[model samples]
Target: MMGTRRSVQFGDVITGMLVDGVDGTPYVAATLLVDEQLGVRLEVPYITTSDTAAGETPGEWFETKCPPKNLLLIALEGNISLFDCRYSGHTVRHPAGIAVGKITPADVVLQDRKGDHSDPLEVKELRSDIDGLTEWTGFTAITRHPSVDDENRVKKLDIELRTTDELIWTQGQADMALRTTWSCDSTAEGLTINEGVMLHSTFPAPVPVLTHLEEHRKVASLMTFIFGCPITWRSHSVRDQRFTEKRFSQLIKQNTVKEAARPDPTEKQLRHPLASPSQIGSSGLEAWAASYETWGRFIHPAVSALNSPRTTLENVVVNAAVSMEAAGHLIGEVDGENATYDRRRRKTTATFIYRCLARTGWDWSGICESRVGLARALAKNYNTIKHYGRGDFPDPLETYLVSSTATLVVRLLAIRQAAPDATSEFDSGRHFPAYGRLVEDFKNNGLFIKCDGLFAVSS
Candidate 1:
């Protein structure tokens, strides 16, 4: 909680005593559970207290009867606070003190104090780590100091790297930077090097803790789209300028809670990222940041579908298609096209696909031989899945190819709009091996014929 640390995952259950944030009233025994679907919840059971001042008579009290106040759960693992809790339901009540009820919270915060504090902590800076960020950035923090023998042969070598902070983006008074840090350890067997990327944000003035966290999430979303994966926050902390005070808070939103920890992509796996450090350069990243402010509404759906671990093949196709359609309308308007771009009289999906492909100058003929055939196939498949309920879904293989193709198309369009000069690198097979392989897969598998009837008509 002080710095970067492992975050709690779903299905973790912590048992503790529940205390009311206001008036400091201790409630009955409770358990805090995080679920993939149900989200963060607290289960409290009725309790019988013999400390009644009225007499020797014991009374039973249901924690559910307590007012809807922010509650704190003190467990051995850590202290967590539940905010905006409401009574969900309860079980059988005949057992008096043993009946159990549920409380659903709109947000959950870890390592936070009792919620009665009137003055919230002001955040001067926020720092967090995302999975695979180090690899995606292609930055290193390790340096080798080698000592040679008298014969010029290597004798001893020491590895060391200093912590570095590089400015990535600045918007008015607020600026975002990337911090790379390394640690070295000498064990009985050998030495080990650990490196990571920390996303750092500094505000012009002390901002609300929630605002600091929102900024982190927004940047993480943009990185996810660029990296072509679910770049979830591994750990985070909010602190003052001098790091004298540190606070940890997590918002338990639907998207944040359901995110699963995916392993970082290996060097081989990252052979063809949608965007890279060398490709984006320093100035290009700033341009990308600016572009995201305007185009994020068009890009988020595609990013979510492509990166979500639980996304189905059908969802990938439908989401990619919808995102491309929306983005195409904007691109057309930006290019001063005469077509009226509106929801009521919308252009066909094929028309949008063609426009995006043309704008990016992406060579689609390698995949389908004919660009027209490819566009028609994608549009037909998308329309069948989205508009017709009776149509059969595409086979798993064809669906995968179509999803991959759409993802690449989206990336091309994004790069073109953000950093037009970098778009040429995507065409080189030597530069983007993954892109070449995808095209090769389409050629080998004959995706054109398969996608023609991607969604079969039901008899």
Candidate 2:
């Protein structure tokens, strides 16, 4: 029951008292500073006493005290638990006889504390809204109708809809729910409507906040995989059902450690998601979750590389190629035919890529359009850059195409393995135009013929 208030943003400063130890320990007045890229830091100022005037400073205090690595900061806004904090540096004011030392935390948790407790608060449920999740879920909670006067001029509009909260999946002692919430505001200028998706997790028993956070991250990663974007938590709140003193006291707003900065996709870019809830259906989602749990070691990094905004084409190509090779080995282990053949001779990277592409039932000829197989061409390019200093580098444009095609192939293989029924939906979706574009680019650049020759020399 946390109130609808704006959450803390980067660059905001909160004044508080830093606690070094358990009860009765002396506290230092400090300020918590949030950074856009460098994460959270605590600044504590030290003043010189009459006897030690100009002799002791904040740096000396830190060195002498050797404060606990993990400290707590208590403030009016909330209590921040700083973990793995390290002394960054100190700024001295010689004339004022004061110095301020900075402590950077590896992890930070900001939470509202309602009452005093000897032990840490236990979290029973966590609810978080992810950016771009509404579009990814494709669940609409609002309908609009325009009203016009007899003059045929539109005067007002009527909006009607029902909020949806449905249980999505359940495992032993845990379950996940999807909630679509909407809000409408009428202003002087016009009416504004906003819709968002909130993911909720309920545990059988109350657990520590860190445990709840791990659960939240697991679901967020799944959303990131399906949404085909770097999904971030828009808001997060936790509740303990055991606390029944008041509605507001039962729920607390919390912010975990900030994630690394990455490029956010535009609205248009989000329109063409890799997969949607509506397209995949409930069964498909369950399958996807299972697949991810089993194959995440191979799948996660590839998806991250493909969707990363700051990486080079060479980096993306290498990551995608490695993932494909790993996935191919996994596939061979499960399929009897491939397993038997592998016992005689280890499968090549090209063979693995070729087998994965075939499983997707996707026609590679459309993109490759080369005498050499698509797998061989991709493997050759991967080796060219992976084993650099041995051969002439590929053209930049060609490398771009190879990176794009390899990532797309990896995506296809993932979907085919997780939800074969959704392959048709994916083929007819936004990827159709993308596939066509790759074909045209290859033809225009004459890479189709050149790729075949490149493969021939490597063979």
Candidate 3:
């Protein structure tokens, strides 16, 4: 046979051989083909390189097309692995704040280092105890770009982290992973897509300002809240006697005995053997009561009830002294001159206005200001105490002036920004003025009596 007569020999080979053309150009001798038993083969394919001549090279540039940098993947090492596998295509950049899906430690192995198969350098589970210097992989953007619609929006990001290790690959699974859901909290400042730029602008700087009087006002307000006394008390007793002179005497006698027996401090009774005093307003009650007759009618009867308490009178007196001192300090600080109109007659005239205020239970919130308003408040409280100073209201006479004064001084020190240092020497019992004496000469006497018999108040 002309084709195969015992395989007639020809000087020609097929695959991968270069044959010279008639025009003296070299060409591939064979084309690639696949067989069932053997895989498709790569014949001598053309390769373009920098060393190749312009026309002789298959192409001047090689094109490596890969997924955009935004595609994210988690390596078997539990790290994000980004592929810039694009040799040279279009220049794509990743945006900031882009995240990748779950990266488990089971999927990767570390390369480069030598280790046995039994303990190969493989990904490890996350632990609570990670050292500060330990290096762990996380997803981050390769580049940042602003959103077209909103500049704040993140345009693109390579949410995968890269590692020098093998990744766990399945038959058809893509290299990257996607996270469907996660939780996070919003911060006061908005987030940024780019690490270099902060998304939210900084808040305006605060204006320099100063005002300390407001603090003083607050202290005054709180003081009033805890210690305010009622402004007035209405004596609910009804006079039921018929018009008769001798009847008045019998009536007075009967009422006196009845009042004495009941021992209720609230009952309005004649402290003296004579006339009932006029009911005055809360204003100026202290001065009005200074008269022997006026005080005798209220004070004596009231004191009789107090004296009958069947308790330790010494404790009562000490407590009263302390309270009086405290009341004097507070009222004096606000309006000492008005607290006691005359310096010489403070104890006799001014007295502890706060004590009087406490006695009457006046609402102090309404009366707030420097001197005049405080004076009015004091007068109102005092008058209230005198008229309605009965019942379970706190008494200036019953509270210790030392304790009260100490409390007031402590409070004053707290309220004041710069206060003189307090000393144990000042807290001594001997240093405290007597309660009766302090109230008696509040207008005349100073806080403490000096060796020269002068009044001394805290600064």
Candidate 4:
């Protein structure tokens, strides 16, 4: 009464799995085609992008859903390789990354079709006798099905592994694009209607200052040792040595760390009032990590309100609250030993936290004074906004400057609390001068009116 599924074997269906994410476009690769068995004629679209014309939205200049091409020339750049096994009657399990398992009847059979998807051609199985059948260049993805109902009826799932390293998606890059007009469009003789400026709501991550990244890396490395586990980061090298104490010791013994190549710190820089390595030891790092995410929520605008395209006063005020609460909590619990958060406005919290760090031998007199003023303003505004739901809206410039500086200050203070030695790594070719610079700027300048760059990113 029912037809048995041949393409599916051992709870695994390989033939009918390949599919596009949004459109359900069938994936018919050069060496694999299941359209006939799946009973679907795949329609591939040629997707590309170009400069937006006048009146077009920013980066909205994409050519999508174009007709299928005779052939797709993709340079996967060593990213498009997958392993499989073939069997006359049974299928094998998919192997994990970089592992070559023993071939049993071969895990899965691969086709070697060099023609287009729409082109009619006889299907042939790839054989060892074929020379180029071992390799292919195309998109790679996996599809899984999970039960969706009480009856355990399966719901098909899709995963897309395609990558895009092309778009700049930078503010300055988009700002530089010129507006184009059609030849037939003529200018009005009277008052010209100015085009309304389009704002970017998606907060693209900014690039990190190289110096801060260096310090953060050291702090992160020191953290792994303190936490007794590998820290998850945005990127990593193959077998990263920074997280491995043995490798770090080996590098230090060999004097191979590039940062350490610089002659010994003129005892003055190391012993500088700002460089007291004994200021704060690893006492509350665990708490810092646990609490960092709370304040971090405000710093990352996208996380705070994902649907919001642009920064608002609420974003800034909430961040201010986050910073102040964190500062108050740390200063009261750690420095004052009061066993609870002080629960004050940002200005008062900043003052208390600053004094707390100062008592611990941290030098903050060199910090920029303007930032303190902003903190005071943020405290006052945050109080009004938090309760009344009304305050000065934070423009992009203000959000980038004030929010970033405030968020960093609280986080850096926490890092210092977790591990003071995190400030410098004599063994590794790394230091925390950027952390020092930020401390100096925050204490001395406190200025947010001017910024050398739009924003910073971290790895």
The residue pairs found clashing in candidate 1 are none
Q: Write the per-residue lDDT of candidate 4 for residues 1-459, one digit (tens) a residue.
A: 322221211122122222212244444332222221221122122222233243221111112212222222122211111112111121223332111111111011122123233332221110011001011111122224454767776675443232222111222211111111111224665433222111111112222122223223333432322221222222110111111111100000011122222232223322222122233322332333334444343223322321222556467446546645555544553443222124542235435434333323333333333333333444544454466565564344434444544443444444454544543352121244544555445445333231122222211
Model 4 per-residue lDDT at 436 = 55
- Taken over the whole model, the C-alpha lDDT of each candidate is 0.63, 0.64, 0.25, 0.29
- TM-score of structure candidate 4: 0.28
**Model 1 agreement with the true structure over 1-459: per-residue lDDT tens digits:** 323222456788888777664453445478988886776778876534343343211112233244354666767666666665667776654435335677886556565552243334455776777766687676778779999988999999887787787547764355777778666788999978888877777898877656666656555755666666556666565555422225434445434555534455555544446776666665665666666657766677887885685788778888888878877777774332223223566556776776776666666555664455566667776776777674686566777777787777776776666567764556543446556788677666754533332322222
Which stretches of model 3 miss by more than 4 angstroms?
1-150, 154-327, 330-339, 342-344, 348-370, 386-414, 417-459
How many clashes would you count in candidate 2? 0
lDDT by residue (tens digit), candidate 3, 125-168: 11011111011112222333444436655665444222221112
Q: What is the TM-score of each candidate against the true structure?
A: 0.74, 0.77, 0.16, 0.28
Stretches off by above 4 angstroms in model 1 are 1-96, 99-122, 152-157, 171-173, 182-193, 206-210, 227-229, 241-257, 261-268, 333-347, 389-400, 427-431, 447-459
What does the lDDT come to for candidate 4?
0.29
Model 2 agreement with the true structure over 140-204: per-residue lDDT tens digits: 77878999999999899888866777438753355767777777788999988887778777788
Report the number of the highest-TM-score candidate.
2
Order the numbered candidates by TM-score, best leading: 2, 1, 4, 3
Q: Pick the candidate with the highest lDDT.
A: 2
Decide which is better by lDDT, 1 or 3. 1
Residue 342, candidate 4: C-alpha displacement in angstroms: 10
